[model samples]
Target: MTTQPPHASGANGAAIDLQHVTIAYHRRVVCDDISLSVAAGSFTVLVGANGCGKSTLLKAVAGTVPVAAGTVTVEGRPRRAWGRRELARRVGLLPQSNVAPEGILVRDLVARGRHPYRSALQRWSRADDSAVDEALAATGLTAVADEAVDRLSGGQRQRAWLAMLLAQRSEIMLLDEPTTYLDIAHQHELLELLGRLHAEGRTIVAVLHDLNQAARYASDVLVVAGGRVVAAGRPAEVLTAQVVEEAFGVRCRVGTDPVSGTPVFFTESVPGAGG
Candidate 1:
């Protein structure tokens, strides 16, 4: 595995901290004794096979899941302690599943992200309009800003959701499989946009299925298996062949990407394995 430079801590030191966190679902434990810290303004990716608690961990940090045994803190404040508006201003989450309003325009969908900033008496201020416009432009959705969400292609819909998150303008963003169903080109496009956002000082944590993409875009990677973190650090350090074999039970070769110098995995089918 090729090593990359260590990521610097965020300006606020740590953005999200999970201390001995445990999550259980329907009387069964999903994650146990999990501890992790994401520095502010850093891009961290979580990778693992399905059912490995990647989404659960993101939910835990987003205050959507009940922690069985630990604490989740955002910027030195317990997540549970923060009120709705306060929490919304500090962190934004893009869940794996979202329900788009029937016949809702893209601009309106993105505008929903600004709900936290709106009040009963004061609504739709210049700042909100600017945030919405900027988000639309940043995600390359300006041309179709007025189009209905259901009328867009899958990639465009995904970008619309990302634009919504961008509209939130939170310092930290938690995304669960942001590139779930897209072609290779769209996947790269989305990740490249996220990389640009990271460069602009947004703390981003995402659960990704593509290890190569995670290595290429993330400044740090956290690998979890069976609901516990098996490795955490630079992608090259954590995404070794041994770790891949152990966590995924597959034989693979690890190499460096010529273009990005990130670790890449080449899976080799073993003889006698079922097709």
Candidate 2:
């Protein structure tokens, strides 16, 4: 059995910290001996091939998946040490997929984010209402506030779900493929919204599959491969040709994007490689 040592808080401070953590389902290990620290107020993006354990690591940090070893902390405190409600108030997770109840109105769905703030005997307060409204406006969902979530387009639904997380009012945002299944325009829109949220001082950690998008938006990039971190640092430093080829098993050219000036990848062509 692998044992994790006591977790020491980051000297620079962190919003989410994982120390020598391992995640497994049954006996199949997913992520092994991983140590990661997301600095407060950072726009950190996780990038890797599918099934590389990036999403699993994110879930582990969100406390949705139990860690087989090591500790995950929020604001320097063990995640499990915080009460459920307290934890919910500190970290909000926007899963890749969220299925709301049938015919659930958007505002009502977003209002559920305030569950941690309300007890059985307590009614909704003015603060709750304010948070919900603010989240709706922030995500530009006020236009569809009355529509059922099931009736909205994919991008709108994603924004609605994001609104709920915002209403939760957590300091750290853990999003898994939040822009998945959306068209290019919608994807950019959602990323812009996240950028705005980060600008407001929320610590954002997201798993993004698009390497270009990850480099374009991320203040920090973590590249995962074979269930471990292959590279982690600033996008420019981490998304090198060597790291990209090592992680993705493809040769690629890494250069500055003409538009954003961030690193962009161009796959090296192999003649007759494709059957």
Predictions in order: lDDT: 0.87, 0.87
RMSD of each: 4.7, 5.8
lDDT of 1: 0.87
RMSD of 1: 4.7
* Candidate 1 residue lDDT tens string, 1-275: 11222333433588888889999999999999999888777899998888999999988877888999998888888888989888887788999988798999999999999988878898578888888999999889999999999999988998999999989887788999999877899899889888887887788999998889999999999899998999999888899998887677788999999999999999985546887
User: Model 2, 1-275: lDDT tens per residue?
Assistant: 01112222345578788889989999999999998889888899999888889989878877889999999888888888888888888788998878999999999999999998889999889989889999899888998899999999887888889899989988788999998778999899889978877777778899998999999999999999988998989999899988988888888998898999999989996435865
Clashes of 2: 0
The 10-residue segment with the lowest total lDDT in model 1: 1-10
Clashing pairs in 2: none
Q: What lDDT does model 2 reach?
A: 0.87
Worst lDDT run of 10 residues, candidate 2, spans 1-10
Clashing pairs in 1: none
TM-score of 1: 0.93
